[model samples]
Target: MQFMILLDMTIVNVALPHIQESLGFTEAGLTWVVNGYVLMSGGLLLLGGRSADIFGRRKLLMIGVGLFAVSSVLAGAATSTGMMVAGRIGQGIAEAIAAPASLGLIALLFTDPGERTKALGAWGGITALAGTLGYVISGLLTDMASWRWIFYINIPIALLVLVLIPRMVTESKMVREKGAGLDVAGAITSTTGLFAIVYGLLQAVDHPWGSAAVVLPLGLGVALILAMLIIERRAKDPLIPLRFFANRTRSVINTASLFYMAAFISYTFMLTLFMQQVLEYSPLRTGLSWLPLGLGIGVGIGLGTAFIPKVGVKAVAAVGFAGAGVGLFLTSMIGVETTYLGGILPGMIVFGVFAGASMPAGTNAALHGVTEQDSGLASGVQTTALQVGSALGLAVLVTLALRDAMGEIQQGVDVDVAMTAGYGLALRVGAVLMVVGAVLIAALLERVDTKLRDPVAEMVQHTA
Candidate 1:
């Protein structure tokens, strides 16, 4: 289930062109195909997590899987832009409900410290593998069959999850106070605010900042976000407890995660374009090119796991971010004449390794002090930061890159050269952002014991 949800996040990158052709999507409109899933999922994740705590994790997981299967079929058969985007939105909502619940189940089931560490390592490994394989799988499916198969493939996975969840997992939830209720208003305000902001950014791809098309949504979005924050304060059982941010380690990690994911997501999107549009590589070749990155991530995770007990989460994460920043800088140096081995491989390897290493450290930091009752909430918050960052990064960075490309085209630059230049610019900015995150992590992330304990599971028991 985790693999399927995470797979959808990257699989669509390789199939963007095909989807555009089939659905008659404009360049800016194409982002909706990706954002619709991530934005909805990110925005509603808090509610979904809390809902799982209030309802039952197993029940929510089954519901989410069922919805996901239906959404996949909807996406597979779509023939119009609206339909495709709608289908993706449905998938995102389903993911919001399922992902944290699934993680919460793992936390619950693995009570022993040693068993918990192994379970989490295995879970994180699967997530990395799913993200890595998504591109290759999409390429093979899109080239051999059709882009629609990417969506259709989820049906079997969903069916299997639906069947197995009931039999294998027992139901569990947090024990809430008698008067507690779901925070529907908080969810609405947050989700819609995020949507408005993303919509405004997308409009900037073609319209100026001053234009009402851009300004209206941006203004509305900010206001709604503020309203949501205010509402969270007043709600009896807030979607996100404001005091949760009082935990400095969790707070810093989540803040840095936004920047980390923002850079990473935009990097992926822009690199895909660089590979296919500028280099004219076939989708299969482009997919194959990403293999090194996956391998690097695996290696990084292994090294990080081994190092965290010696060096601490702060050191591991800081090193990872710094190394990834350097990798992004190297990647930004690519040009029209550059070959994959000569240019792309080095950066991908460095970025993949460091990026992979940082993930476990961040996850540990975010969930470090959380009690079992808030396990789903903690996981949801971290995932929400990542998903929201993905949407925001892609929207902002991609818009800047396209805007620069358009400017170059006006100056009579060759089309391919202009595109390459724009991509380079975005990557450099992303690299800088990554470096900034590293600095912040080094400065702000609280220091903890360099012990080889399962922080989350043990801490949950300790706090409880």
Candidate 2:
């Protein structure tokens, strides 16, 4: 279930051109095809998480998956930009509901700490693999079949989840709220606030950063988030308990995850554009180029599963971030004449490996000390960070790229070369973001690991 949701997040990237051409979408409007789904999912995740805690996880999972399937059908049939955006919003809402419930259930199913760690590791690995597959599969489908099939593919997967979930998974008991009901006020405020901030930031690509058009929404967004904090503090049943932030480790981990994802997602998006738009690779060839990245991620996950239990989550995560930083830096060195093997492939493998290693470690840190009752909310928080990071990072980095490209275009440079320059700038910035994320982990996450023995590590290594 988790894998499916994450896959949907990026699978459409390779097919965006086809989607835009088919739907007659402007570039600005086209961005929404991706961000609309992300923002909605990120915005509503807190509410969905608590819903899973209050209602049954199994019921919510079924509802979410079913909605996703229906939404896929809608998207696959979409002929207009509005229709595509609407279908994507549906997918977002479904993901918001389903994702946290599934994460909470993982905690519920694995009562033993050792077993729980292994399950979390498996979850992280699978989610990473699925995300990697999305690019590959979407490219293949878009070239050989149609862009629509990228969405149609989700129907069977969602249906399979619906069928297997009831038989394979058991439901967790609802956490009774002490308040009058759901925190409707908090939910409204947080969702709107987050959406506004990301939306406002995206406007920087078009409007001046200092213009009222950008400042008003961004300022309003910050104000609304403050309002949400106040509401959560006063509410009898807060949507997201303020106490979740009390854990220094998890809070910092979640924050770092935001930066980590911002860099990583932007890198992926720009890579796709650089290859297809700049280098003129066919979609099938582009898909094949990503195989090395997929392999690297698989290898890194294997290493991380072994390392996290021994060296600790914080250490592994920090190391992974550093390696990713270097990898992205290498990518920024690409030129018009560079080959895939010489320029992009090595960096892809390097970053892919590190990203794989960080997945389980970061997840473990975010979930650390979360009780079964609040597990859903914690999972939602982590996932929200990821989605928001992707949206925000893509917005900022792409703007940087476009801003530069537009300058060159104004100077009468060829659009393709100008765009390549833009990609280079963004990739470099992404590299810096990775370094910042690494610094944050070192500065903050060191003590997050328990000094005491891990039973899982004991069983694996039989060591000190």
Candidate RMSDs in Å, in order, are: 2.7, 4.5
Q: Write the per-residue lDDT of candidate 2 for residues 149-176, one digit (tens) a residue.
A: 9888898899899999999988885646
Instruction: Tell me the TM-score of each prediction against the true structure.
Output: 0.95, 0.94
Best by TM-score: 1
TM-score of 1: 0.95
lDDT of 1 at 403: 95
Clashes (candidate 1) = 0
In order, what lDDT does every prediction score? 0.88, 0.83
Per-residue lDDT of candidate 1, residues 1-464 (tens digit):
99888787778888888899999999899889989999999999999988988899999999999999999999989999999999999999999999889887887787764566556667778778888898899889988999999999999989998889889999998877888999999999999999999999999999999999999999999999999999999998899999999988888889889999899989988898789889998778887888888788888887877777778889999999999999999999989998999899999999999998997788777776777788788889998999999999989999999999999999999999988998999999989988998998999888743223355668799999
Considering every candidate listed, which one attains the maximal lDDT?
1
Score residue 259 of candidate 2 by CA lDDT.
81
Locate the minimum summed-lDDT window of 10 residues in model 1: 448-457
